[model samples]
Target: AQQQENSEKVAKAQGEQFQSLTQIASGQADIAKLQNQYSSYNIRNGMYTIVAAQSGQVVKAQKAGIGEFVKEGDMIAEIVPDDVKYAVEMFVRPLDLPLLANGQKVRFMFDGFPAIVFSGWPDVSSGTFGGEIVAIESNVSVNGKFRVLVQEDKDDRRWPRQLKIGAGAQGISLLKDVPMWYELWRNVNGFPPDYYQPASGQKNSKTSK
Candidate 1:
């Protein structure tokens, strides 16, 4: 009887020890979970002035000046890499939107630079450089115009190295190549040049795949 009683006491002690250890382990897990949630909140809200993932020069800062109200999620800065390729952005008339397609060749005449541009004769263009339509934003911009992105043409002259961002450039998307004499005759006859129309089964510029 004494041996049985001793064994019962031992089993009860072991059960109590197991219960205590389980409670301790559960408490530690709760602490770890809380710590992880705190860390995640700090990262999402940015504990410090946001750190850039890559090293580069900040060309512009969009922060408000001193004494100005700062808003959450406002841009902190604009960083440009050391070796950046530039592209010109131009807004197109809504009526001309249908004529532009992906990879369509364009001619550019930069403002503040002199260039005698012949729309139909891009090959003989003097100061004008070549580009191609890379992107077209259907969303309307200022004055109800659509935005188009143009990049350097690999087959033609390169853009001027001195050109800076925000510089204005007039662009013309060339379509439907024709004989030079036919263009001149059309101009002389006061005929408006024909716009490009894709035939059946051709990709639509507005919805080009």
Candidate 2:
């Protein structure tokens, strides 16, 4: 009878040991869950957005006012992504459109600032990205200048009218900001020639007979 009593005592001690281990494992799982919750709290604390991807003339959106509420994905302001080399676009008429091709080069001069007789697209790290000739409505404008879009780099997106002033000159002449090498090559050769005069507003008007 004493031996049986001792056996019961041993069984009771083993049961208590198993219960203690189970409690320890449960406590460890709780700790893991709390740690995950703490990480999520840190994520909520750090969140922001850049004002604009590129810098240029910035304009406030029409809805933008002091303390105005903005819905998600609503534009807060406008940014002209003028970081890419500027390209002057001109719409060529149907007859003139055929004259233009992927690699057909042209000479361009700025009416306001004409110091440089710029030609062709700017020298890109990628070998001369091609020009795109886009088609628009024929009867849109009274004076037919069909949309002939040409860009050095392909990052060109349509912005507001005022932002694309020099680039929007009409007629067959397209003033594009081409690669640096192309301009230099044109200069070395006699392509643009000496026809271009600097638009410094320094010409003597009185000297003309």
Best by TM-score: 1
Clashing pairs in 1: none
Error of 1 at 102 (Å): 1.2
Give TM per candidate. Answer: 0.56, 0.45
lDDT of candidate 1 over 159-186, digit per residue (tens): 8887877888987766677788988899
Provide the global lDDT of candidate 2 against the true structure: 0.52
Which candidate gets the maximum lDDT versus the true structure? 1
Q: List the residue pairs that clash in candidate 2.
A: 120-178, 121-178, 121-179, 122-178, 122-179, 123-179, 123-180
**CA lDDT of every candidate:** 0.80, 0.52
> Root-mean-square deviation of each candidate, in angstroms?
7.4, 16.6
Weakest ten-residue segment in model 1 by summed lDDT: 195-204
Instruction: Please state the error at residue 172 of candidate 2 in Å.
Output: 5.5
